[model samples]
Target: MRSLAFTAMLLAAPTAAQTAPEAQRPIAASKIVLVGDSTTAVIGGWGPSFCAYHVTSFAACVNLARGGRSSGSYRAEGSWDLALAEMRTPGYKNVWVLIQFGHNDQPGKPGRSTDLATEFPANMARYVDEVRAAGAKPVLLTPLTRRMFKDGKLQNDLEPWAAAIRKVAVEKKVPLLDLNVESSAAVQAMGEAAADRFAQLPPGSAPIGPTATTEIEVRPMAQPKLSFDRTHLGIEGANYFAAMVTRELAAAVPEMRPLLVR
Candidate 1:
């Protein structure tokens, strides 16, 4: 009778642990992993702020984004492999990949550019499939708009690539955040001179020397820079865009909505 009673107590211990409050839960509710190009990378993108301020304690946010990677280059260079490995980690209640690409996939950028009509959408679709295969959910974001203006209106060179992403998201039923449209509208509202505040250099600050996306944000803070980019992001830009991402995720991805805190 003592042996039976002891076994019953042991089994109940684990059951009690399993029912603990989320803050005391052994496994977290979710993990959010950011995946994409410079616009999503830390030193130049929204990844840092999105991870720092938006996620709840129930979710651990991991930014694996690298600057200068297009959908093609990110995989070709093995960066995507690193990101995929993160998705495979055990114990998370759920994992999600937020993907944004387009700026580098346009024209002029050599190694990163994909044939917009074909390779671009194909690559995005494959990422969604692979993330699902790895037991993670995938959320697609249209490439963020470059804050450039000519004459009276904001120049939207990213329209085609954003459209391609939209098409793939619809076909695959992946959650889509149209950052290209939303960001451009935000930039235009600020006007050209003021829009520069969103850039890695902003407008008036003295150059803080030079830096890269992979460093600084993870390490000690450095003078803000995106190496060869002034078009990327400054702190204000990261916060602004990160908020946009959080807002969009709430609306489009129901699973992540509850885990997002202020």
Candidate 2:
């Protein structure tokens, strides 16, 4: 009888290994949703690298940015609705949406450009308000700088748009990531020739012209054809800018520091 009772006791008890899985479970899963133009999209932007390398397993990083999207058009085409759905998704302890746009918002892009003085700031402010309404925090990022240089100095054509974004961030009292300033300074330090290494492909024979301020429009297709440009990012550029983004993001949103790889 004693031997039988001892066998039953042993069978009822759990081993140390059995409780390990529960202890290792993620404390609170968080989500990060990225929104912007091609510069923040998957194929040719830092968003891919940031999502893949910078985020820990406890976080979900979703890049919803598409090429050729402006602040006005991104919502006009139903992309913002999808983002709102993601923000409202239950179960995440915290949801962060990083918004960056301005490349396509610049003049000359049909169906994408917005009035920098009026429409741009209003669009950005609406984004901030809507993100809050969806129960998520919004971090505004100044547009990434275009890597065009003249007379051995980087040309910051997008400075106006960046300024507009800064105003919106301040007025809305949201976290701001000044990518334009940081990337501009970095590219200036690297110089024009060295910065070409960041392009998706080698620079074409055509000389950099005044009209080169804009990126060649890239539309979604079955098989997207990527080419070398001053704006789009290659693997190396993606990693470099992605690291910059991660560092600044950690500072801008201190709560996300532990989930980011640095």
Candidate 2 Cα deviation (angstroms), residue 200: 0.4
Predictions in order: lDDT: 0.85, 0.93
Error of 1 at 248 (Å): 0.6
Name the candidate that leads on lDDT.
Answer: 2
User: On residues 129-165, what C-alpha lDDT tens digit does candidate 2 reach at each position?
Assistant: 9999999999999999889999999999999999999
lDDT of 1 by residue, 175-219 (tens): 899988898888888898787777776456566664557665576
Colliding residue pairs in candidate 1: 200-233
TM-score of 1: 0.82
Q: Model 2 scores what on Cα lDDT? A: 0.93
